[model samples]
Target: MDSLRADAYLQHIGVPRPGTAGAAELRALHLGHQLVVPFENLSIHLGQDVPLREEALVEKIVDAGRGGFCYELNGAFGGLLAALGYEVTLMAARVFGEGGRLGPPYDHLALRVAAADGSGPWLADVGFGRHSHFPLLFDSRGEQSDPAGVFRLVETPEGDLDVLRDDAPQYRLERRPRQLADFEATCWWQRTSPKSHFRQSLVCSRLTEDGRVTLSGRTLVVTGSDGRQERELPEHEVLDAYRDHFSIVLDREPQVAPLDA
Candidate 1:
């Protein structure tokens, strides 16, 4: 993508031009992305195709005003960062699932961004909802504090780094860089396999100034920043919440696929 397209991306995420490819700009972009683009699996449930191509991903997220899971969100964000002159790499990770089991190789896509000064490569992920709100210093082995929670990257016995959120293992990060296409098979499985949560559930969520709002199936949940006073929206208002919070205008209710027997 060209610089003009990159500027449009900046506008999509509601971030102003930072004038340079520096750590500050990277952080701003990460924050803007997290605040604007949400983490959702609605398309999978809508029976919509989840394409991995950078241009299509950008069109979906930026032009269509939509949100998507890791592959779509991180894939597009990495392209924007690369277009804007940052050194960006697509990295694969294995999501930590039930019973601490690693899901699979390429279970997730994340970004490694480097400053123009060659000072650092930070873990800048806007797709991992509930992750650190800003870029986490990649070189730091110590516990890093952020608005999301206390996070740490610990080297595993097998040599990969385990990202811990509040001391819980989130995902094991592989050091090698990857192309967006490398995740195609797993992305397919995730959207169609019975064992994959995305195939059985429907969710749309976005971060708000006071808290976060989510529509899981037909349940509308609102949690405050302090994580208290969680409440469910009335059945009559659930659809409206989807439109109001997520900017998604659905012609009909999104079907939640049931777990396969």
Candidate 2:
């Protein structure tokens, strides 16, 4: 990523270029990204191939004004952070599923960022839907409280870190750093495998000032301090909801592809 692209990414996320990349700046960028770029998996259903390369991810997210799942979101965000002088390392994680079973090797992608001001080594993840609003201290073992939830990083006997939210395990982080290409196979599996959850549903979600608004399939769900409200949208209104809520304009609404397709 170049200076021009970095500036464009910052503008796309509605954030200002920080004079120094530090903890505060990291928080702002993390939150700004969460608020602006949605966590979505529409490509798989839209019959679109999700390329894991940096240039393709940037074009889709920044230039095309679209959002993507973990690999694309963190991959692009990591690039922008590195371009802005942050020491960014792409890390692989295995998500914890039902009964605490760990998923595949590269089930998720996150960033271990060392800010320029020496305030970091923070776990910066903008792709996980409904996760911590800001970066979490990487080395902190105690519970870190955020508006999203109370999070804790527990070091396992194997030296891997288990990320927990509100006392529930989210995913396990490996110590080894990874390259964007390393996730290509699993990224392919995520989008193509019939068993993948992403292939089973369509989701587009973003954080709002007070809460969150999500479009899961055709059901629009809004949750805030007051409470939660959900309503199913007709086919005619689905495209408008995507535009109004996520700034994503699609000619046709993405539908779940046939299992054999």
TM-score of 1: 0.94
Compared with the true structure, what per-residue lDDT tens digits does model 1 show for residues 1-261? 777878888898899977888988888888888888889998887789998999999989878888999999999999998888899999999999989999889999988899896757899887877788888888789999987889999998988889999999999999898999999999999998998878888888787766777778777777885674445666677667778888877766677766663
How much lDDT does candidate 1 score? 0.85
What shift in Å separates residue 131 of candidate 1 from its native position after superposition? 0.7
lDDT of 2 by residue, 1-261 (tens): 999999999999999999988889999999999999999999999889998899899999988899999999999999999998899999999999999999889999999999988986899999988899999999999999999999999999999999999999999999898999999999999998887889888999999989999999999999998899999999999999999999999999899988898
Clashing residue pairs in all predictions, respectively, total 0, 0
In order of appearance, the predictions have TM-scores of 0.94, 0.98
Which stretches of model 2 miss by more than 4 angstroms? Answer: none
Residue pairs clashing, model 1: none
Residue 236 in model 2: lDDT: 96
